[model samples]
Target: MQPYAQNWTHVTEFVMVGFAGVHEARLLFFTVFLTMYLFTLVENLAIILVVALNHRLHRPMYFFLTHLSCLEIWYTSVTVPKMLAGFIGVDGGKNISYTGCLSQLFIFTFLGATECFLLAAMAYDRYVAICMPLRYGALVSWGTCIRLAAACWLVGLLTPVLPIYLMSQLTFCGPNVIDHFFCDVSPLLALSCSDVTLKETTDFLVSLMVLLVSSTVISVSYGNIVWTLLHIRSAAERRKAFSTCAAHLTVVSLFYGTLFFMYVRTKVASSINFNKVVSVFYSIVTPMLNPLIYSLRNKEVKGALGRAFSLRSWKGQ
Candidate 1:
């Protein structure tokens, strides 16, 4: 192993060259990102607020969704604000300190992994509701849901610690400029001058463990759901059951699909400009859409929204 310069000699700050070649459209970029950021915050907050205030939505599905909304709030925040700042005066986001960068990376990874686990838990809840309606009440009691949610958060918080610690011990004697919107693991790894093989391998194993396990749970749950749906004599009941899982399935595909491409792939071209866009998609777009996808299509959420608004109007009168 080559000796790196001492801490004082290492670069303390990194330049984030976000959305390169868009200098002329800075305002456009800022406005768009700011709008999306506000939307994500508002929509997710509304979900959390609605689920909290409305007794009608206090069931297991919405319980998980409330937590998901809470997670989305932080997940999108970890990256969008910095990305928005990058669009400021020329070379704006070029000053993130090493500590700040790692903090962002850790929080981002934690929330993302938590969402993966939470989604799978929700899938299991759906499977129990559909495939074993007779046992639904006992199978997914409120206490069980709470424990599952707790596990998701606790496990997620632990997932990135080892990898981040390993990465932190590495020397960053190379260029301090990151070519992406945020301090993602891949871009950060690319900037390190030290041997990153161990860190990379650890990251891969951890990612595989999280994604593969969650995906397998979801797949098995859904497979059972399909089998049960087929056995049902009524087509309407089948459709209703399937509809309930549709939004979550869409969210899972959007999230896991992009995640697999970003982290699981064997080789990510160093010069590829598409990575930032993909990062934006998950870190920003997905959070903004989760509420819309889940709430708009969900009849109970819509009913609750209607009631919440009606009550507000009546009080104003």
Candidate 2:
């Protein structure tokens, strides 16, 4: 072991000091997070439900969206409930077992990575639909969609394997407090007694590969989309095409904006408080807004939702 690794206490537990200096407003924080969590759950669930039950929504775009909704639910669930606990001082809100911490890290990282690929795939789907309107159906068949979705999940599941292994091998010393709400990579790494230079580099490379590649693909797709839109002579056609992609673009911006701020830049360059705030946006706020963004911007989703509710009402009657 290195000199730094030798100093570790081999601590088996950690205290998550989430939202420090906010004890006075813990109740308010708890109430707010609780409400958001519920809304996120209901909204995401409704998306999945509407997509699954409606035959009209069985196309490639909605198929990916149904899976994306599933990912969002689990992705946000991995952190918010525990953060809520911290707010209300339940289950020793500050304390977390070592195993629990690792589990949280793995799940959060896995789902997050998966969402990156899924988002890129979604952008590609839109690209096909808008740019190659005639070939969209044959190009984005059910088999192809399933394969892409599986690849996203597979790659996401595999990408974190090394990172998680690196995290597990690290030694934790005297200070076991994770300065964030969740067991995120940086906060947990900050507690390690091991020399994390290699670990940090590995994480950066992994994040860059996943995020940069996906961002590039989405950007290119949208770039082409913009170029294609310009050539359309009809004002109504251009508006419809742009509107179709606006919701996805909004989602991509929100996800990547906070993500790049946290990871793409120098690690630990920002204050822990700033990182936490950004984390809340990407991890909590973004997931909640995805369903709303898609539903509000999408005519098909709205129509499906309307039909679903109408059918439910008729059944109840």
Candidate 3:
């Protein structure tokens, strides 16, 4: 099977069937989705601001936390605005030029990869702090964090570039109507009229890479965390350690839980919608939840918030 062989040529534009499935519900969907985006933006930005301005919060972990917020802002931008527009009849279906489609694919994959790796990094941070109290500082130093961050961003950007490029080169001469809301990889691949052997192979390999790399990192980090937790002599210390790890664990579970479901069960067609919900979980819901979980559940984040509010109250009074 030829990878780039164009079968049904002349398909240039794609009809994206976002939330317009029910015409009556379109307005409601738009309102709610728009609100979600607004809140996600505000929530994520607040996290960045709170972490940045709070001198007490100026630590390696919080530094990464801010970056994750920034990441969510960009990640959502890749899909939501256009989706909302389609709901309001401003743009029924975007005639995404070939270049635009690939660019979308690249950014989507890049952000997805970055988040996966960042979650792993956070997990490792928790692991080191819990499992190796004495050596945590040395192992996950500020310098090391920066390097890991750079590596994650670089991998996030570069790893998907080739595949997206490869996928774009393949001809899409058939039905261009994408069933899903966004211009994702799998759904896009289904639209291609060309034989997708190479593309599927590449996708499978990439899926394996995403799963193996991120999961392995989290597993190793948590393994160390567990081993260290087992050595705790007092119940209070154990609780303290558990609390510190809880937020990160929640994020890891949320991310990996959805991720594994999507990629792991790629064989079934019904799994696609399931994957969409999972993607929604990570893309839409997780950003809001991250700040809530980290701040509301975390002592340090709560303390930071308290200090922030106190300062504001004093200024107003």
The sequence of per-residue lDDT tens digits that candidate 2 reaches over residues 5-53 is 5554688888989998899998999998888889999998999999988
Off by over 4 Å in 3: 1-8, 92-94, 265-268, 271-275, 310-317
- Residue-wise lDDT of candidate 3 within 8-90, one digit each (tens)? 46666777765444579888878887888888898788788889888888877887888888998999888888778887888
- Candidate 1: residue 180 Cα off by (Å): 1.0
Top candidate (lDDT): 2
How many clashes in each structure?
A: 0, 1, 1
**Clash number for model 2?**
1
Mind sharing the TM-score for model 3?
Answer: 0.91
User: Please, what are the lDDT tens digits per residue for candidate 1 over residues 1-317?
Assistant: 66535543587889888887888998998999899999999988888888899887889999999999999998988888778777885455556999999999999999999999999999999999998889999999999999999999999999999989998898887599988888888888888888888888888899999999999999999999999998999999888999899999999999999898888754555655888778888888899998999988888887777776786755965
What's the true lDDT of residue 246 in model 3? 86
Tell me the TM-score of each prediction against the true structure: 0.95, 0.95, 0.91
